[model samples]
Target: MSIITTATALLADIAVETDRTDAVQAFVKQETILVQITTADGLQGTGYAYTIGTGGTSVLSLLQEHLLPLLVGEDARNVEALWQRLFATTRATTTGAITSLALAAVDTAVWDLRCKRAGEPLWRLAGGHRREVPVYDTEGGWLHLGTDDLVKSALAAQQAGWAGVKIKVGKPHVFEDAERLRAVREAVGPSLHIMTDANQSQTISSALQLAAALEPYDPYWLEEPMPADDLSGHARLARSTRIPVAVGESMYSIMQFRNYLEAGAASIVQVDAARIGGITPWLKVAHMAESHNVMVCPHFLMELHVSLVAAVPNGKFVEYIPQLRAVTRSEMTVRDGVALAPDEPGIGIDWDMDAIDNRRVS
Candidate 1:
């Protein structure tokens, strides 16, 4: 009962919806790469990795041209070995983002197969640590949603039983950004957790200043105030501000998390499954973060993230953006501020075939 057979890749055009108007930020369309693997016993497992915007086709090309051939007849259960081979072979052409992202698709598909074979949920297979993870409805930044729309959305999240909320900042002027924060914090009230993110959209000086200015309202963590690559700069900002710095999403490897931990770059670590090469590296990063006493708050892929967060002791809040809610066959269920993990076998993803068919471009 091992994955030693190779199968073809299934590329789907998935149209994931975002809850952003013209004022907050522009909407995003994703070209999803869906991998299909059939076990020797005739069981099929499906895993998905999406590259948003324009370069999705290019990413798929890399997966097909470079990584897929290496995986043709290998034991899918030997995930680590396969991953190592993929990394080592691609070391010359492209080693970092492009290759890591491709590996994510392959690794996820393998995990899905393994979980399905075992007839257990991914969290159970990964050692279920908690039943449900608290959720924070991540909203308020789209460049298209105006400040008023941002406030309304934050209020709506609160009314919907979200334990916390995240808003976007990094406007052209510091004062204008502060004002937007003030409105949302007031809208959510004093009890709820309020977090702000800049999406790697700020200068060091501006980030520090913004953190200081927004301190009175007490944000849960100031996220990605600066770019994810500037560990030293983030460390400096963390030292200078009382508001805890939150990072990840831009981090692609375990070494990057290590650097952030050692440097105290962020108090909260947000891991993106697609960006970090899939669940294998994601687990490593989660364990590493837990060991270092840093909170693990994963970004996006909320359906999959529910299981991962439930498996970690230091798991913080799972960001709930709800873009996939309208698209996925089984949307996430959030009750009284907590997101419940699916009890079904594998990653528990119920793909919406119609949505996939409608969104497919090629």
Candidate 2:
């Protein structure tokens, strides 16, 4: 067994190319926390987690002061056992963002190490159900863009062979949101899939009204209409709306997903791998969702998620957002509307050390 000899964590900040807004908050910059674990045999695996703008330092500190220390001298190949140890030790913060993000960096590095040791690509190591998963455009759908711009972007995405387009909801009025969806529907025609997300911005009643108004456009799903904690509210909305209810990005635990799934609160699972504590629990959630006959369309981190999504039979769509391009060596390739999983022997991204070093804050 290769013992973990060194563990390190660092912080870097990457600016968004343009101002992006949803109903809840304006995405300003990405504060990424990166982790690397080196084994006695000279093998190293890297992992990362991020925040939209805040809490990155907290995540970094958690790794350096608490989590990383637990890894030194442990067997690097024992990914599950290590994850359980970290999860149990961090019980005080079991259901929060900072803890999950910190755990994610460590958990993913272990997975990368495992895959590299086996000499298999992550997707194949992950189950290899398929090599390419469908893609959707969310970057073009920020709420700040006008309806015309929305239509233009949706059409451009359709022309470029994207599988679907997501439009941000939570406008001042239900009709404004409806009008934007209607315009995109008309422009893209009937065959193209359209998804709408309120970013946890509405009340149950407001979500009901928006869902009714959007029913005519045949949206594939209505996502996060209310706050993430409101399981009963989501169930009510799911039952009341014709559009399928999709959620899980803001959720921080597997039990939370179970609550949503059992309550019939969510039809599509949008679990973010980092937020759910990396590939270990991520696969657990995916398999759990699969057992429930639900599909997973993970949110953000396309470079990483593409492989995870392609790994499982129930994995459906990969949200296309190029937030990590500047700090990573390769971009995920989209061919005929599907994002192909990277064939490299570990987690897909080859981090640009100089770029990360230049942006390092702590």
Q: Please name the candidate that would achieve the greatest lDDT relative to the true structure.
A: 2
Runs in model 1 lying further than 4 Å from the true structure: 19-25, 93-95, 140-143, 325-327
lDDT of 1 by residue, 1-362 (tens): 47556655556655546544322244466667776777666777777777655567766788878778877667777778877888788777543666677778888888888887788888778768986889987655555467888788778777877778787777777787778778878877887788888878888998888898889888888888887788899999999988999998877888988999999887999988878888888999999998889889998788888888988888878888665654577887788889988888888788776776676656
Clashing pairs in 2: none
C-alpha lDDT of all candidate models, in order: 0.78, 0.93
The Cα RMSD of model 1 versus the native structure comes to 2.2
TM-score of 1: 0.93
lDDT tens string, model 2, 54-74? 999999989889989999999
Off by over 4 Å in 2: none
TM-score of each: 0.93, 0.99
Report the lDDT of model 2 for residue 284: 93
